[model samples]
Target chain A: MNAIVSAPAARLVHVPLGERAYDILIGSGLIERAGHEIAARLKGRKAAIVTDENVAPLYLDALVASLEAAGIVSASLVLPAGEKTKSFEHLMTVCDAVLEARIERNDAVIALGGGVIGDLSGFAAGIVRRGLRFVQVPTSLLSQVDSSVGGKTGINTRHGKNLVGVFHQPDLVLADTDVLNTLSDREFRAGYAEVAKYGLIDKPDFFAWLEANWRQVFAGGVERAEAIATSCQAKSDVVVADERENGPRALLNLGHTFGHALEAATAYDSRRLVHGEGVAIGMVLAHEFSARLNLASPDDAKRVEAHLKTVGLPTRMDDIPGDLPPAEVLMDAIGQDKKVKGGKLTFILTHGIAQSFVADDVPSSEVLSFLKEKHPR
Target chain B: MNAIVSAPAARLVHVPLGERAYDILIGSGLIERAGHEIAARLKGRKAAIVTDENVAPLYLDALVASLEAAGIVSASLVLPAGEKTKSFEHLMTVCDAVLEARIERNDAVIALGGGVIGDLSGFAAGIVRRGLRFVQVPTSLLSQVDSSVGGKTGINTRHGKNLVGVFHQPDLVLADTDVLNTLSDREFRAGYAEVAKYGLIDKPDFFAWLEANWRQVFAGGVERAEAIATSCQAKSDVVVADERENGPRALLNLGHTFGHALEAATAYDSRRLVHGEGVAIGMVLAHEFSARLNLASPDDAKRVEAHLKTVGLPTRMDDIPGDLPPAEVLMDAIGQDKKVKGGKLTFILTHGIAQSFVADDVPSSEVLSFLKEKHPR
Candidate 1:
């Protein structure tokens, strides 16, 4: 499982969204093949590539050359890196640039970075001419496994994260696993948190597989591609079941509620706590809180925490370097999450691994007390 | 047909786009009954009303009072009036206001003005939280007959008008005819252009009826209601056939190719010429151009011009109140239209009245020569 190779056969995950359906191709060296793959599928020969400054320096040229080689004309916009780029100002800039390129309805806008670029560019694609064909060339593990497959494109407002956007699915997704090799150790671990989330949601067998083979995944082997494929497949099923998050899709928010609150508590400073780390802690908290409610055994929570810790992920809130606001302050952030309905506390609590369910109207007092107990003294 | 009355029974136009289908209710006193009508359909009790200053002074209070009477709590934002308001700046302000109002996914955002407000507010409603229930309470004649029905919501950018937007269908539309009484004569005449448009698009009988009943439609009687209903049904059928404007929908732009160029020439200044007036002139041009191409008889072009002129609409370029650009420049603006694909000219030419058809690959030189012939020397 840990054997390293030059390349592997590409794997495909089809998002079954009827007319909006698309394919996600995962393997090493897929980025070099992006232009040919896209040209084969789409009718238009024009594309606008949106990437961050960091990614532009690394992958933008190769992607452009590939496109030009395939007789596809391309223009590129390189934005500053990070989460703050998911904003209305940047959305305006991206939109203007795409329009400036004269990319029409059938032409494509390609997202070529991590979540920030994917979300913002997808949003711009969604609105420019009421929607241009979109393609995702996710350059980070987090995006490849998550944002790229889901068409939830948006920008954050002063009001909240992802508070403005549209559901504009991509025409195709190219997840080049080799790019994950360029991510820092911390970023890689953070992405693994979401990969683990899939198993925790409904696949105990996959969770056990990760526990045994996560190291091979980190080592950039066949297991890594398998893990990413499985995560995308899991998400695709949920999206097909409920594209708009009307029902069972809430399960995808398993640790997102607490994760987002923690992100807010830190002012979204990635140095203090990146999204995946917050989610790592939040997932453990969810399992532990469920145990306190007697819905799951304490041993299950411990097992989950132990596996995450072994992967070098921060599984406790105190793992965050900076001082956090009081538990009640974090609670306020939770109340502000878009997922909270009519001020009711909605959470995904687990009965055990692979047994998560949406727990709505959970009393605020109980959540506060649990957070208080879990807070650093 | 011109008999005056206190109120009239509401007329309904159902846009059947499957699950996104909605109803447009047209009548004399629908505004006074807005709250009851909305409450009957939507589940959410919270609404955010977006109206412009001109409308706020007149109908905002009545709309608010009606909503309140029906047990709906609401918040209102009054933007400045005019076409400039349909922009990214206003879009951000509206999105922020909707978020600040805490209007959730299930809540509603109601647009209570003309095309600018409806387009901008509908865009905000479409994007805030991926989508919110939308209601359009169009307060102008142009909106009631045309803009309010298609579910096309967007904002203008430096690139062009409606260059950015989404296809967010409204849950309901209330086009109260009594509001037309408040429009200035010019504004009313401008809106009548679109009513004439529906007839020119596909209904020869409707065009003939409007020609015979022009005085009564202007007098605000049964003919007015009948004309509005017929226009909406025409638009509804077109929208149902091509909700995204991919195919048969292009016929709806019969006059728009010339109309949009005229608007762009005036920099969208209402003091010079408004949208419907531009369409009136454009519709005439389309017919004449068709005659030049021998696709339609010259008599048809004369009839369209005669009917529009009788309704007090501008039916020619020189009717505009200012110095015009050269026909070449107007043709340049037409080239920049989003509908123009790959530099090929596309125009809605007619075989005759009620015989509009999309003509693609039209020769640009032919268009330029035709424009020169029509321009005032």
Candidate 2:
């Protein structure tokens, strides 16, 4: 608890996964110090930074300069910005670039943007030369709080999102909170959905804190850093407990199953629904579904929705700015999720706030009916 | 000793890699027993078999029948048989196929071909759903003794062979020696190169045994089983000692540095030189280079060449049946090898028979000069 509330000048959350353990450094201006920090921890002096076109103009130069100052040589590959970048084609390009740069097993492949770049680059680093040292410099709040902390690096395939990937943990993560200042209001709000998720999964007090200090967190300062650190810590705990997602780690996907379905339903058009927004709507639906199942109170569902809505997040299917498919279509999307085992629905259902449990035998008929009742006319 | 000579019914060499440890079951008719063996060891009832076109007609039906007999539902993906099949295109295909088959994490992806299919499919299995249980039903000698044992799964990039891959260990390996009956004389002889490699690396007695009983081993029975079992055990020991090739595992790459350069020189053209043929020549070159460096007697080099030549394998650049690349070009290929650390050449030089060691700082000038001396005009 003390660690979570520590002064936010810079928060270092260490993910202790034995030999693969790494530190997540969250602070302002950390990117300016990226070179020295990376050189101090990693043996290789060469790095290949994979960023997006959007982020490249913003921070790639500064990052390269920092690495140069630390005497670490680097090359940069800037891909198109967006969720579409997480594809096999992009993965191959990044891998080839890393190889062309002669980034060896000990050399670093740094992901210097949001989740897409982080995931795509992290995957290239994982497979190129059978695994290189990976570093995540997450630019968005969503990534800094969630994706960057866990070593779940991968790309999306036609069959589904994140259906292909590796569990390649990073050697270091530099989450420069200052960069969050550059995010759009929607992007920042979308990221907040994940921050709220950490609390909803297991930390009721943290959820309560975010609810009380939502404004301060949005304004960005000690509160923002505190929120990010706690979220990372929560994710790290889940990841370390079940690094392979064999059991309790499923709790972290509380809204993801439904969220992924919604994203699929919207054809993953960011104009209609981005990942975190899908998650926002999905989290509300999860709570509502739990209530319908008599597993939690409907008041808890309303509370979840209200917090997300207050943070400027989309909290319902109708909240999406496009016409979604029928409930049956959404159910088909859920059925396609890798989470289904032996043709049975497996979901993270809650008893109440911060009390999620993995329900491995959730009936599909029940979910379809729930979606039907909630579907926008 | 008893373990090595156990009455030839079937030999199970347990690779003791802690939690990731698995068994290599080597014997005749094991493919017919693959389903039972896999079912007994794995919890999954579903499997996706990735095989090359050449092997599918020969073994796919029998494998499917065996799995059906054991109550395992199976899907088969037939790919073209060759080193070229180890590519990102095929990797994506296998991954997509596995996902389309809805193979869960607990399910299995079985490789039922040679090194190319095993490498590609194992990579897919490792990544799909972040990893599925993998089973290797290696139908080729090279695969049975080497590629299938180590869990070094990957695809080739335009940069190099095995330049991209993952360390995805299989849950079980069924090395059906009876499959060897279907192999061509050339293919069998090519595989014999790796069988002899185990002996050359650290087993003087095994080398002497192979030299004495080479005929019986080639004839295929107890001696052939002994050769494969010994090779697998030797490889398992090295992998257990260093799974990631950070240390002693480099010894397994004995002859491989020169072999890869030769393969590159020939443009990986199978008609010009196959992998094991390159290895056959490279082992001779490695020993000859060791002799030139005064690391071992020239008599040892002569002996290595004599055995391989007697076994109908190419033992020199001149034996490659085509014009050879200039020494400088070959050196360029060697320089590009991932084994090169900070621009210094790394090779497996030997002290004497069965006493190979990783030479981390081998002088490139010496290698060039040695290649020039050995180059055929």
Candidate 3:
């Protein structure tokens, strides 16, 4: 992890999925070089850039100019920016726009925003023409560190989030740290939750390093790039080991099960809690639940809550504004989670910090009791 | 092929997709034994059957009884029958119903009808939980031989048919020939077109055999089972070789490009033409187109048209009930075909019967001119 941070040049984390293998380039100023990198990798000269309203004004011109410099003709689709945009309605819009753009199978669909844009665009790319060449230009830190690296892409349904989609890997992923400099402080902190999640998953040394040098990471430079690279490397390793999330990959969802339930409980209202914020609280809850189950030390849960609180992330259910539903309602949402295999809850519980493992058939009564303690009545 | 037809209690064609490999069981009485076969292969004791209105009344109860006999809990969603049913609306309905049934990842999603039901239900199964155990109990001849074996599951979009879907293979396929006895005469003849397609796609001897024994196949004894198994074998070979339709799999699209265009021309009206009828005409056009390009003898084209005509399948654009759009309009639709690469038309042209190859850069003017001859203004 330190070697990756100390590297002077741009870092390339290769996700090895045999024939579907591709590289995730992490460093400063990647958006400017995206054209050359993408052109070098793919033979197509046409591209469709799918961005959100918030992102297009900031980076669309630069990306289009970069592609133009590389002799790649391009079209753009600017969607509304928010979690709400990750729905079937927006999915159809993206699919239609792509087809209308005449983007062929060999051409590329460049997703140029956060997780919402990436998920929606990747899904459109996967289905349109039965599949198209896809490139991820994840502008947000949360997406760059996590969502961009994995092949999981989908839109949310009324039933649940990401319940309908496919595993369509991108041909290339450009994670430009330079772009994160433009992010608001709150947005960066939300994304940092995911960055910290990697360390909590299996890297004790890295978690300790973050505890010491998180200030430098927030200040933004080599440390920020290193954190992103480390996160990508960590995710890539797990994905390569289990592309379909059949086993070890579930470890990556340590915070996600509880996080998704929280999101669903709020009806995915981003103003109340964005994905990473929900994850921040969710991770604490996971640790607490682990401690409750005697799977881990209570001190580990306290440590997680303290660190997330220091970073200005929500670490408790109370952090969310307005009154949420009862604990039983939250449990109902969790029951509907995609992780519940064969009517039994499956969770990533920790033995200690950086020692996460999948625990299947987790008793729902225990989860309800835990939530009940967190939210009285 | 003869060896497979003769000494078989039930012919098994193994589709070798490595880890995703499974067997296609073909014969009479397989439906009665479906529950046992599925229970033996998969650990789950629950299934959600997605059939259509026409099929549910005919076989749903028997299927339910079979599952009960094996101690497998089963539920079903009966959709309206037809090509039009393969839509996002119906897809969402199936997804919701399956979720409402609480069908877990280990459970199976059984498609128990023709092409529409198979495509839609398979798609629902694929996306329900990022995929579920899919079983194809295809009832119609079209589905048994063609759609059921391949994992290409999806819904038709406003842009084109099958424009939105995933390549999700089934865990097991049960194609009972006895079910074909109940199909309408037109539907049976329509399905025979796909069965004959296998023979036309690289198996000259199979084509010869099909031409000789088509009447016997229609009579529904051993010959029907042989033809279905042979078609599945032919398709399985191509699918296993190129699971994603990247190379040799394109050969399977011999008539689909023209056929899809014709379907679009007729607005996908069953009163005018069904999919197989369109393919029958499209196959003749493809042969005639190849002959026009001096790639094959005109005699081959004539023989194909003659054979299709003898089978009571439409072999010409004139045979379609309604008037078609002008040649340029047809060419426009063909240009929008998903198979088009980089805006250039890609066709599967034949050298002779059963000797087809992917032909790229086919000129629009040539296709338009050919269509003009068929439908002069």
Candidate 4:
């Protein structure tokens, strides 16, 4: 009998959830042995492959064959590509498709796509039959760096992105580096924001590495591999300690609080802006906000702006275009923000580089004024 | 400082998710002191309460008052009542409402209501800023007994029920039995299904206890007050051990695998059959299925039916005006179930009154045959 084995790279981080905490095996060659790895997670004789259009044409068939090799019959559910698919209607359609294919709780769901696929499919895997076994086969660099490492899954609604979802951890996360080559230049760059975020949140070294090796990531070189893998390790470490985002895990939202607001303002499912672009701008805003409050030296704040600009990411509203939303709009966007409590604004500000604090007293007025500074001139 | 402490009779069941593991605190009057207990899980001064029309009108102000007493400023978001409100639109509305309300990341969200409210609020909590702090204040027995303890949150779809969702655990679960007194008779019975499920899934002694004191549950007597708390403990213990339902946790599906199908076929929001009523009937079907498969004795099946019926539950499909729905329809409903994988069936059937086996068999033909027997006029 082929028993499940943990990946060497995954061991760099440990899941903090005792029995629920398990290892995440990430590598270019990881997919080859994935069947053996996931066999133990199944209690039934079949499997379901949930993927999106982008990744399906590339690896769907191969994944199905892998499951078949493991004696688990497989069926596939291919969703339309892009963020638009992460909706209530789309989620139900996927459920219809799952039922149409006869997926069951005893069987496992192999999420064979990028972040959007992983989010929607992970969510599908999370709630189907209350919960089904799922293995993440992330085909995007961003997903590999952040999404695949954590078990957070959900769909987007008109109100906001990922507003309806769960923290359903996967049985296994198979982040194959090989798929990175398939991404377009724009897509590759988009995923890098998270790579950058790991540094902004906790891994200062990884951030420094990205600053030094930005070209390698863009050129797809040797250093790029280590950068993505290192980012994954950083994320995995945090997630292992705080899988539910109730404590230290909230630190991961370094760019997201503001980033999500901007994304929601523009319509999350639209290509008007990728999540990374928003975060790129959010990082700059965060530092500026940090400096405005005397939490960080203004020099460090400038460095943040310059570094994000060096990678060709948006640092202002004009970068994406349209209009500078009013504070009420921004407030409306941030108000429904996950950080708010009883109308209190919680801002994750930095006292300095490698220093962060969660505060509800940044004041909406400050948030609005700072965001206004980013107004296109 | 008056810390929110568990009831004297409250039993704690710790979920085993490494650092994410939290105890399910069960007892009467737990909600009155939830502010202190849940506030202990945080380091901030803000709290948001997401509730519904019916529940909020009755307890929202009281909850807010309690939070203020604890020096925690609280905000409340009240939506329309009923399961139909558990929609994609509502999830977005809530997220935006909260974000616009300026809730802080340091502030936590208190999910207060029955199952729908718990699910939608929990789901909203999941994606806001990538997950806000969550405290479940279950107001109904169903919410208290099942939805509160486990972090399962989501919305229903046009195709079926709970098709879109996630597993977002609460930092603390506040199941105050006093809330149950406000439930209508039907609502009370609906809540009982989840509580009774604990006994059916495991712990025969608990099942016997139910048989002895079920009168008190309907009578709403203190004699069975511990029953509410103990039932939650049983569930919380199992969920803690298997937070993601990989193994031992599946036993909790004692009647859900089939019950969800009935809910789907009948349209769950219709109020024609409350979830527990369907579950109560489902327990009967599951027992019969087990006996037919010779996994259980005929006597065991009879006792299971008798208990549910004595509690004013329907033991057959005739309770609702639905047809036998062809084998294909039954197949379709089961397929739409959150547990389907690769077109196969996974039924958690009882081998006896207190033993449930996650069965990978019970072929499509057998299931169709069973449906024919159970649904035939």
Candidate 5:
């Protein structure tokens, strides 16, 4: 037997019929608790922890130490950080590194950076042979709250963000909220938008609590940590029910439709207006569009706007900062969105502050009017 | 609303549960027939088609012509080929190309290539402004029988092949049998592995039928076409039931674990083999492993091996074109396969033909022994 000894205690939630059913570990310190868990699942082997240059500098050593402590050997695959790093070329780099390191399936993969690392590494994990097993150690706020929880993974193509990839869920997702302390406020806030989306879509109680506890989340406190972790429960369950965003689970796209357009329109080059900030504006626009379409009341739009503004997210045109691209440019780019059915536009419009719908067949004229009104050139 | 009213209606099989219901259209001439079907689904104002060079060269003009014939204002994005091309850089190319084409939210994206193009384009559609609609016109056998039918999309990274991507099912999948003519005999043969898998995993009767009819299927005939389309139905039904590889549906990985190992051992280089060829060999190995373990009867192993060989697929070390990779090299690569969970291999070993189990905690030594026997040094 290997030197490692731990409970084969991790639970695999059977999504049924079988390979898609993933496990969820409500454990503590797994990022550094490698061997214990690895031994239980992997039968005591080393792991190659794939992180970014940005993340490895901070935690790769600790993860390596954990694997060693478990009597397992370990390696590090640290790539340069940036959204651009989450590309097929970078995925190839990781695959090559894994090959160079001779990482075996007997070993595990610890994706130790943020979403990009998790995605790049996890993606490498997926196709390393048609797949591999990896854990998610989300360093970025966006990852911990969103990307880390879903088995959804992939890199970007020149055509778009995350154009190529798969639904390769992690064996374990280690979201050390403590890591958020190291994140820039903007990145941390970007993650919060997804956390808040949960409340806005299904859990009004969480929304109420979020409104009350807005300070803690923005401030990045223990309470926010609990919220983010527990928030995973809701998302995980939703994912279990609709892992492909096929049903009600699509409510998660609350502000994504309009927000992504705005982001794409802007070329998403300006860091000043990150995804969360765009969502903040997009949610407002969605509410405004809903009101305009008589699908929602102005009060609902105002409520969503207030919630975002209160969280210090931008709710208007001036909120878009940095060298911005034109609205027409973003619109043109957004035309490539996957959500478009045939040649028609689809929108996730809200009926109220917390109720959303993935409205198919929405006319472009109406959508353009929404865009023109919200961010007039 | 541009020209001819070609209502290429998609034949949708609802996996149920509201929104997750996707369409699977299996008919004669679907890939070439995409424009009208896609345009009809174009609940939007404009549409874009994402493809690769190999496909675009053969099909783009016709697709564009078909769309124009339907009076739809369409645009196209042609990417390069191989796993290498599904990168963020290429994704950007599509993004730029789409933007240049003046697409709108009311438009849709047609993934008019094989799996690579479908993945990149589909993912682009998925994330574009928080999601857009996309139609899949799968050209490769792998895509037609497998990938194109599922909403799963994404790109690769330095880490792996399809490590990054999303599970966004297509509004419709157009599987045109005519496209099979374009693939080299090797590629066509490679895709047949998956065709073989469906039968091997769940339908022994289908397996028997394959033994009877594969000649016609490969040589081109109504029965072959029926079987191919039926294979899509088999997978589509399974996907509708599971959507993700979470349940009994995971039975699909019958040979994938070992196949992925072999492929990874080769770094997915085409020089060694195509993805399907690796899978073909892996299935034989799995059957032999089952027989060796006394889990499956020798006759079952013989039957499985015989079928693969009958198709001219490599079933033994001698059959593997080129030198067999070193045993240790192969085994070590196997160790990195994502299928290995915890230190044990979770193989889809069968008790007999069509009776498989997701056996976890299987000793790696046994795995190495199986390979030693199947792909001896």
Candidate 6:
């Protein structure tokens, strides 16, 4: 992996949602400038920073110094790290601490970790005082490319992941690629799945570009920043067009249905499958399923699987550790997906690479049989 | 209270929020039509009905029958009735039950009771699937005129009331005046405070109309339907103008700031002071505070107090059942109000009745002194 140390100029991708539109700033060293960027845009000088234990030691001081340098006073709550932190108990704790800190409406809530922190903090911000000005300083590649851009903030309930949340747009998103350097190799590989997702969604030229530049992206070069910018722009366009996901926005969930069911089948054990890893495998499954349905060429499925495998991401059910549940169990979990409309399965299927569309009224029997063939348990 | 029980034609009040807009159906026996009304708007055939213990016996069967008649399959979750049920525990129960029922995004979560059920159920709906189709069959006058119309759904926290929730609008609201006949006189009087709140906010003509026709409104006459419809219209307009409470919508909290402080002081003991009754006293305090600030005439406060007294609503701190805390404590509670902006007190101080506005940067010292004068502890 190449290490290019000098910080590049930041690129701004604006998500226009009328009054709720905000900008996502992408580059290395953006976190050190977050205080200035946020203070310039928001009127209030006080803020509450919500982060996790893993992120606080490495990044919290720089964040605090930046805020202090900008004359912005802040209080913070450090939660336990990982997906389990996205719970009602932690949400309540954050809400109480925010209110206890006297963080008022005009003041901001800065989510300074990965997806869990962003979702939980954004949710607390969304509900406290009806809503608060929110700033996202996402520390992981997955959050920078996906969760941080969209206003979909929430926590996981036992029923499902991200089943509870609100569409709360951030006032600003600072996606500092420098933070990604601290992430483990496995974790970085996981986030690359979502970065690859945008290319597969509708950008064929971008997909071709990613296939060539995947190594530079992994190596934290200018290509890394370029990929993040491209992903945010794609997401911003979708979010602005359908902020509420009433129509076209559903296309963004290209691999989420199968991804979520796979996670559920594992009982959301991160040891077996992290979200983006699940998406890696799910995307491969979706492409393969499309091929099986004769909607796409088998070559496209092979291409998707090959790229995901090259990135060191899991791209098949067999890639997950341990004996898997029978296909019927996985099928049942898919039925519980939020995308299912009136008991009909809705899948984001591809005609070929970068040619995805929402396929509603998908035959359940076909899915069950496909899963049965794939699992063969 | 008179018991004139033949059903009247429904009155429809449209809350125009562009595409997010919905209609509030007010009159007698609208609950009996809830199934068809909701079925018409949403394509999904399954529903999860959320109600409280008190409402289940009184109206749940009728609601189920109505849905059955419309060929809508249903499941139900009955919660303990009252303000206490609006907690995290019940919210989790409701979320779990809805997911267990497999209520899809296109399907609905019907809130079939009063403000407590509406707030909790609507919150469950808001978070479940990120959001679900919602229908409000409000069984109490307070809910019909206030909570059901605004889409301000949430649960109470130890820090304060409505400290957590989402602005999830219902696809349909059925406000059946016939249900009001079953309420105890005190309960009905409490709801009357919210009805009076609409008039007090910015409708002097409606206030004058209410002052004259309040007796008929209490009697379940045609005036009752008229009163509910007018109040719904008043709230609908405000909600449309500011869906997120960022501006003029704060006027709706005319009595709520002081009222919430009082409720907190009493440990939210409904026996001592229910929400609407607390709002009654709080509204009087607001008017009096406006007079003290020379923002309005003292006679405006007096007139407001007298009208509330005539309707058997509590209008002063002394009307509360228990011995009270010192002014400093009450002042501290007010400091914690969600309306407090940047450690400054914000009040819905009025020019007089029907002339309310959001007053930001109100001095905390001034509030303390006024509370000291009013409480005289």
Best by lDDT: 1
State TM-scores per candidate: 0.97, 0.97, 0.96, 0.74, 0.65, 0.96
For residues B183-220, write the lDDT of model 1, one tens digit per residue.
99999998899999998988989989989998999889
List model 5 lDDT by residue over A1-377, tens digit each.
44544433332332231554544443335565555656566643757778777777787777777777767787787788777787757766777777566565445677888777887788777655445567777777777777777677777655566555666767766665557778886777677777788877767788888889878777765676667766777678778777766666666677877677666656656465667777878778878888999998999888877887777678876677654555666566556665655567777887886677778778877877666666667
| Candidate 3 per-residue C-alpha lDDT over A234-282 given as tens digits, one digit per residue, 9 for 90 to 100 | 9999999999989999999989988998999898988898899999999
- Report how far residue A207 has shifted in candidate 1, in Å: 0.6
DockQ of each: 0.75, 0.74, 0.64, 0.29, 0.14, 0.73
Q: Where is model 2 more than 4 Å wrong at Cα? A: A1-8, B1-8
- Write model 3 residue lDDT over B22-41, tens digit each, in one string: 99999877877887788889
TM-score of 2: 0.97
- Model 4, A43-127: lDDT tens digits are 7667778888777888877776666677778888888888888876776666666655556666677888888888887777766
Clashing pairs in 1: none
Give candidate 1 misplaced runs (Cα > 4 Å).
A1-8, B1-8
Summed over model 5, clashes come to: 100
Q: Per-residue CA lDDT of candidate 6, range B2-96, in tens?
A: 22334457899999988778988887777777777777788889999999889999999999988877778999999998899999889889989
lDDT of 3 at A163: 85
Q: How many steric clashes between backbone atoms does each model show?
A: 0, 0, 0, 40, 100, 0
Question: Model 6, chain B: what is the TM-score?
Answer: 0.97
lDDT of each: 0.91, 0.90, 0.89, 0.75, 0.71, 0.90
| lDDT sort, best first | 1, 2, 6, 3, 4, 5
The parts of candidate 5 lying over 4 Å away from their true place are A1-377, B1-18, B31-33, B39-47, B50-60, B77-134, B139-143, B150-168, B178-199, B202-204, B207-219, B237-242, B253-289, B295-315, B346-362, B367-377
Off by over 4 Å in 4: A1-89, A105-114, A133-141, A144-147, A152-165, A168-217, A241-377, B1-113, B126-164, B168-217, B224-230, B233-243, B247-273, B284-313, B316-323, B326-377
The interface RMSD values of the models, given in order, are 1.1, 1.1, 1.4, 4.5, 6.8, 1.3
Model 4 lDDT at residue A28: 62
Where does the lowest 10-residue lDDT sum fall in candidate 1 chain B?
B1-10
